[model samples]
Target: MNEMHHRMARTCMVYTSAALLALLPVTACGDATEDVPTKTVDTSALQPGSYPTEPRNVADRKPANAASIREAIRLAESMPLAMEVDKQYVYNQSSSGKIYAPELPPQQGDSVWVENFGAVIPGLVVGWTSNAQQREDFALGRNIDQTVLRFSNPDQAKHAAKVLSEDNRKDSPAKRDVRIPGHDAAISYVTEQDSVVTWMPHDDLLIYTFVTPGLEVPPDVDYVIGMTKTALDKNIEMLAGYQRTPTDEMPDLAIDTDGLLGRTLPVDDMNKSGATEGVYSPHAALHLRGRADVLKRAFDDAGVDLVADAGARVYRSSDSAAAYRLVAALIDQLDPRYETTDAPAGMPEAKCFKKSDRRSSRFTSIPQFQCLFTNGRYVAVVDAAQIQDLHQKASAQYLLLTDER
Candidate 1:
């Protein structure tokens, strides 16, 4: 079948909520009418060539003063629960739902099992298998958060890095917090400006988001991250665990991505690279060229009156799931299945929604909303001026990046 036809057929993958056989229909071999034996590929055996090799220079390199982090938690103790916020999204393509929490979870004291669902959500991209190492380190009270956040396992970390950097004009550096196992502990890293971003994992439903400034070291974001880490540690046991389970299961993800075209190398439609004994995709090279072309066209076709990619990618903004939920709202409008309407109040609306000059600057102008698309599989965020052009070109891009979304 042709790519467009395949894209349409994949919609069945997104909409199947009934029979189990229908779950991965596109993956089904032979004729649809044939009652063939189901073939299941062991994910673990997919090989490891797709992972990245370059080291992420921004992971929490050193541990913060334990006393300082604990102190930060103490300061946040009195913060009103009313100030806390939770945002959620249910992807129509893959029935797996996601929730984002801006406020730190409440905590008791020691012997804590404080699982930050928001922070945990980012790890879902690689299946949170790395957390197994963190869990072991957590039991031993070692710096497991550092290992997990550092992108230690080459295959998964590299895969994540490949997808993340696909649209790279540059990498923005930012502060990231890696949770310590037992005590109210954390490791902090001061990322090169626009160079580092956070990927908070929630079991397998990873949340690719950014952090808000608060406790900063030397009175900046670095210090704020430390304070936030400390606060989480102090209330470790007190913080609430989300009523969500972690898994790779996605339901009702019907999508017609055949029109989507990608510059990135094609690898299992998921955009995963380095599979099967470390073979690299020629597609990565293509992705880089494509990103440059799209960006150049965006500047020329639409005035670069306001530039966003110059800062952090909005998906890497304060709450990524929130960012995606907003995009989901737009996608829901574009495609009806994405109709869940519960977003956090005061949640900033998308900047491109309104053409008015005043409204145009409202959301996009904020640094919080600055985000970019990675791996062609993730959500794409365009500046206000480029929205129309993006919409015009979206179908092909969607097929290329998500191919099935």
Candidate 2:
């Protein structure tokens, strides 16, 4: 297999096992029969069983919705998530409301669950199942992750970084050799089962995993992962993810060393810099950022909020940069219940705003971008049109208004 595939496989194996181990007790409940058998089974010793496809009873299944998404994830999270037997029923819900059965159905229904343990090297996915109910535990393609956006939370990547750091201190090998495919070397760490982990690699952040098994990772997952392979790609991807590409040609400016003290990137100049629009719509970014207050002002000021802020910070004096940094620092402040990370592969908390038609800031949601200010600070912006049913021409004013000396 390719490097990324190998890395992903290995990394997934380690973390998946760890995560499964973590959830074992929770899924066991208090019932003695519910306890997971610790018996090891050699995968080679067991014969592969043929799985009969189970017919989908769409009528019995719950219709997909925000609530259903929640329940699916909850069920996946709470199960004694381990593959114990060589054979089991692997059921999946089709887009057309049919349940596709696994090649082998070990067991069925709510009593059955998947596991990740196998004999002889203990391969990746192992679990159990039964066939009475239609609730697909690991249904892919559902918008379950969308539900996670609610309830102010910490970025999973940052949490991974912290875990890596701690593991490094303890001399963990996983921390030293983790890589992010073609992107950068990552400091891989474990997270709750079926979650993502990340790390910082210089100016660019590299995320290692987004563990959503049995679910098709949103196209964005591959898009983000593939594009983040290079520094140029990362810069453009970050901007594009926010839908803020420069519409015009390049700009010319001089090196401003004074603006970049103790900051993330300290470039010599931005002369002859080009511009391009984001891959996603500004409106999409607003919804993704998901902060009502910041969303309001950012969407209104879509075009300039992120770019202008970055430009200004790129040109700001030291005092201004320092002050802005202080505020920027608070963007991803941690919560006792909402643990976040500040290291590589993680995003920091940020104050956000939206733009009005007149270049003034307002409360709206839609156009979104991250502000990199002249004072060396970062803020977030969202699209206005997405905030409501209203639609208007969102003219992002400058390709790059440079200081032409």
Candidate 3:
């Protein structure tokens, strides 16, 4: 809960096998729950936001090439994935980025699907998003974002902008052309959604903004336009940086954050502003590299099969009626019914467990909560600690997976 506690709380999230969980009950969370209290800090004398200012020293900093800098930005904005990295608690939290070819899904030339962007403008060079975290923010939600796509060259960028402008003018309502600083940008407001969308072009990058779903209240037209301006300003600064002093190395970005969660359930507990270092709890921490050997053996022992479909890996059972039963049995066999936690209301009958009891020094002190349940034809492993309300999000995820979308 506090800064020092987070560091000393260096606990790992373990997807403990039944055989493994047995080793802990005697001296861990089941019986021995004593933990050293973390030390407290005094914020009285220090300013609440005190941080080290940029130093005046001028050694060991190497500026990268424009291409490398651009490439780094592109890597940061890899699409299909959510905005894992963005401007955080810093003064500037807006950035433009693109994805390298290898990181994207397998494509056949023009067959790429822009996952984060609207999937319309093809060659996505500078897909930008903002961290305008505030209340009542649709097209401008801090969670949802908008971006414009551009190709490699200026001619391509201008051509894409032209196509978007023509399409917006013909199809979008309340169409208007506005100037951003020295550039002419297209702005459109849709009455049906009460949201505004904008597109601007500068050199090789195409900038755009729109309403995205948010956790808080839905956003309105004014908030979108204002944030678009903010995004545009940040874009101008980034492009300028590319021209002038390039960064030695790009700032670190968030990692691909999925390990123990169900395929349908998304786990993004890392703070966008803080990168991975700003984790709040084990709710978002699941690193299952060395932890899945027993899981594989268990599956093999039970006759369940694993298969890959459309880039996603899923566990399958030969019999449809017995599928859920088999999956539940695996968990039950490992963790008995009496030891299981009751299923949250609306969720299928479930059992819960923690991978580690923090019984040993090698194990993490952090607590990892694993919620195993069944939904429809599949057994679910929902890490309730990953999200705020485990029941609601897991239920919603189950419904969304069942839906026709």
Best by TM-score: 3
Please write out the lDDT profile of model 3 over residues 253-369, one tens digit for every residue.
Answer: 221222112233322422122111111111011111112223333344333443211111123433333344444444533432223444445444445554443333233222244
Error of 3 at 179 (Å): 4.2
Off by over 4 Å in 2: 1-178, 189-196, 204-211, 216-236, 239-285, 289-405
lDDT of 1 by residue, 292-323 (tens): 22222222222222211110111111123323
Tell how far residue 125 is off in model 1, in angstroms. Answer: 7.2
The lDDT, on a scale of 0 to 1, for candidate 3 is 0.33
Q: lDDT at 25 for candidate 1?
A: 15
Model 3 spans with C-alpha error above 4 angstroms: 1-144, 148-150, 168-171, 175-182, 185-192, 211-224, 242-405
TM-score of 3: 0.33
lDDT of 1: 0.23
lDDT of 2 at 72: 21
- By lDDT, the best candidate is 3
Give the TM-score comparing model 1 with the true structure, all chains together: 0.22
TM-score-wise, the better of 1 and 3 is 3
What is the Cα root-mean-square deviation between model 3 and the actual structure? 21.3
TM-scores for every predicted model? 0.22, 0.20, 0.33
